[model samples]
Target: MSQNDGTGQKPQPGKKAPSGKTLARRQARTLAMQALYSWHMAGQSLNEIEAQFRVDNDFAAVDGAYFHEILHGVPRQKTEIDGAFESLLDRPLEEIDPVELSILRLSTYELKNRIDIPYRVVINEGIELAKVFGATDGHKFVNGVLDKLAPRLRADEVRANKR
Candidate 1:
């Protein structure tokens, strides 16, 4: 038996419930990932996708601005974001699973544009997103790619952490 961590839900076996801010940010990432997947599959305009998501999902606990930023930013910067870590991929982008690709693109965007977030947090979040939305082993693949991409994009931060 487990106790409710005061969130009206049982905490996972070894994990505490995320703080409100963390939960909001995580919900933002999740919504962004889903929106990205829809955009990739349907070829819809990002604006349409954003508007639809706003209507379809509960945004009350999500960081709406962060979700909006990622949904729009990733596509707007697709070329540069893809180029940033394309060389590190073991396979071509098309060969990669869309779920993994979206997770990668989303995380890579943060690594490149959101300097407020730490590289390790970006990488870890990507892995977590994969575990939830990706293939059985997709988290491993996401980890491998982000692990390589982080040092390249966050060289100073990575090096500082290493010392």
Candidate 2:
């Protein structure tokens, strides 16, 4: 499997380490997903929920900006994200489990907004999230849907780069 650098650049063999901030951003994204899923399940405000999580878990160890941007951005663009998913998935987004839904939302946001991140990396990260947090077959489901959506959403870039 190919590994990525901090700027989302796929590295050749024996390349230097990814920046600390990049690894922190990935961690922050994971924490944000967990936080968002928690809020969705509890029906709590983002601020209240995040603040409580911070106090309880000392999540301040992660980058706050990365956490805030992903959590807020995903929900802010949820309608459009779900629309993309609906077009790609065999079923409605509502039918997906909440954990799987969170993974999809995060991956979709990155695929749409963070063009620096490779589509494959975005999908792989989502699959990893599903493996850790979702049902037995959830990673396959997330991978399938995101794979279909990635080419469509990134058609121009893919065509230009020959991915």
Give the per-residue lDDT digits (tens) of candidate 2, residues 53-143: 6776655447778788887888789889878778777776678799988888889899999998888778888897788789999999999
* lDDT scores of the candidates, listed in order: 0.92, 0.81
lDDT of 2 at 153: 86
- Per-residue lDDT tens digits for candidate 1, residues 1-163, read 6675433557687787768887788889999999999999999999999999999998899999999999999999999999998999999989999999999999999999998999998998899899989999999999999999999999999999999
> Which candidate has the top score in TM-score?
1
- Model 2 residue 67 CA deviation (Å) reads 0.7
lDDT of prediction 2 = 0.81
Off by over 4 Å in 2: 1-18, 160-163
Q: With candidate 2 superimposed using the best TM-score fit, by how many Å does residue 79's alpha carbon deviate from the native? A: 0.9
